[model samples]
Target: MNLDHLRVQIDSLDSEIVRLLNERINVVLEIGEEKKKAGAEVYVPSRERAVFDKIRSLNSGPLPDEAAHAIYREIMSAALALETEMKIAYLGPEATFTHQAARNKFGVSVDYIATSTIGEVFDCVQNRSADYGVVPVENSTEGAVTHTFDQFATTPLKICAEAYLPISLTLLSDQPSNEVNLIFSKQEVFGQCRSWLTANMPNVKLSPVESTTKAVKLALETPGAAAIASVMASDMYDVDVLAENIQDMQGNTTRFLIIGQEYSAPTGCDKTSIVFGVKHKVGALYDALSVFKTDNINMTKIESRPSRNKAWEYYFFVDIDGHVEQPEVKRALDELQEHCTLMTILGSYPKAEI
Candidate 1:
């Protein structure tokens, strides 16, 4: 085909694409109205998962699966904005990893509210100040985020969805590498990049701050100071990237939870989380766990935290491999409850694919 002929075809295809997108969004708006009348949630995680799965299956493509997913994410994000004034609260001052995770899941079209602490994120959702909240639950390198766990112990919020963000820490500052005398970042971030710092800037003093974004701000303002943060922070704060991929582990990822009023419905492949306090007796913990084995439910993770109300008493948080609505999972949890002083089903959410 001649160049002019091909150019005409490309322009025609682009026009068709725009028309189809608008048509799809019109249908989405009709569905949103029906949902509002029925008092149904606007953001349904199971439906979201099914849509993405279908998109991947249907794609034959010039575009990769990730690229397609990204495009659809923004499309759905725009639909969501039109359907409702959606607000996402995250643990941040912006450009933090939690903020990045929130944006990754919701895309750029929805509104975001940055709260300083995880507790505030929970509170925002609990009080209806935000439609949903994102909080980091655990990191592959740093273990559990205790603040998030502690909030789950008392809050009525449910985990509606989850996301995994691969963390790539960078050393950001305006100062030249040789002139830098101090480094600042969150304690967890410092831990993640400890080896890199020791090997590259051993003489520089390290200061732990409230958050990496906060550290970036301080770095921008303070003389002879650099901050270990995400590359996004470097751009947002206008600091030069001194070093990249500074985290000790190449596959370092943080798992974040989406908290809302209700848990997600079954998606076949899902995860259920619960917290319980065992009776203070021998074999009590073992008896509680044995219920899962009896019902043949797979438990993925377990972490214990001090109950705080009583000395030496603790509450165990567990993640199991099936939705709470599943027969086997329901039976196992029912039996497990018999061995606990207190038991609460935290939430059942679709497992993050990434």
Candidate 2:
């Protein structure tokens, strides 16, 4: 065909596409209205899955399957955005790792509130100040964040989602100097970079700081001193990264949780978090765990914390496959509750793929 004819054909196709998209959007608005009438959430994962399935099954076009799904995913996401906005709370003075996780999950368009502490983040969601809370649950190198687990022990909020982000540590310095006298960093940060620090700056004294932000500030004031922090810290402090990804383990990662008041139904791939305490008797703990075995529920993580209210007593925090609303999960929970002195289903959330 001539270039003029090809241009005309392209314009015609564009118009057809635009019309179809408008029709789809109008239908989405009607669906949103129906959901509002029934008091259902705008984010219906099952409905989304069905839409994707139907599209994939019916697709026989020039556009590839992956391309079609990508377009549809964004389309559905836009439809949900039109229905409602999500508010995410995170531990921050801003630009912290928790902020990164929050933004990763909800995107920059979603409202974000940075609370002073992890506990405060939990309160923000519990009080409905925010729709969801994002906080670090565990670090690959340092293990669980006790403060997070403790907050979970007291709060009614549950883990509605989980995510992992590979964390890279860096050394930020104002000017190049070999006279490194002090290294400022969080204790965990220092630990993660121990090998690198030992090899290169063994003479430098380590000073444990409150947070990565604090370390950056302190290092700025102390000449010949460096702050061990994320590369983001250098950007925030107006300093240069002297070294990057200094953690001893190259693959070091942090696991974060999304806490909210609502419980998610099973997404086929789901993770349920729970906290429970055993009765003060032999075999009580065994009985509590056996519920999972009997019900064929797969346990992913189990960590213990000292009960703050009761000396010599411990609470077990567990993460497992399946939502609490699922029959198999419910049965296991019932059995666990019967055998335990105290119990709570923290939250059932879509399992983290990253």
Find the candidate with the highest TM-score and give its number. Answer: 1
Off by over 4 Å in 1: none
Error of 1 at 313 (Å): 0.5
* Candidate No. with top lDDT: 1
* lDDT measured at residue 134 in model 1 versus the true structure, 0 to 100: 97
User: Tens digits of per-residue lDDT for model 1 on 171-260?
Assistant: 998989999999999999988878999999999999999999989988888999999999999888788998899999999999999999
Candidate 2 differs from the real structure by a C-alpha RMSD in angstroms, to one decimal, of 4.3
Candidate 2, 219-315: lDDT as tens digits: 8999888888777777876898887888999989999987777766677778888999998998989888998999999999999999998899999
Overall lDDT per candidate, in order of appearance: 0.94, 0.82
lDDT of 2: 0.82
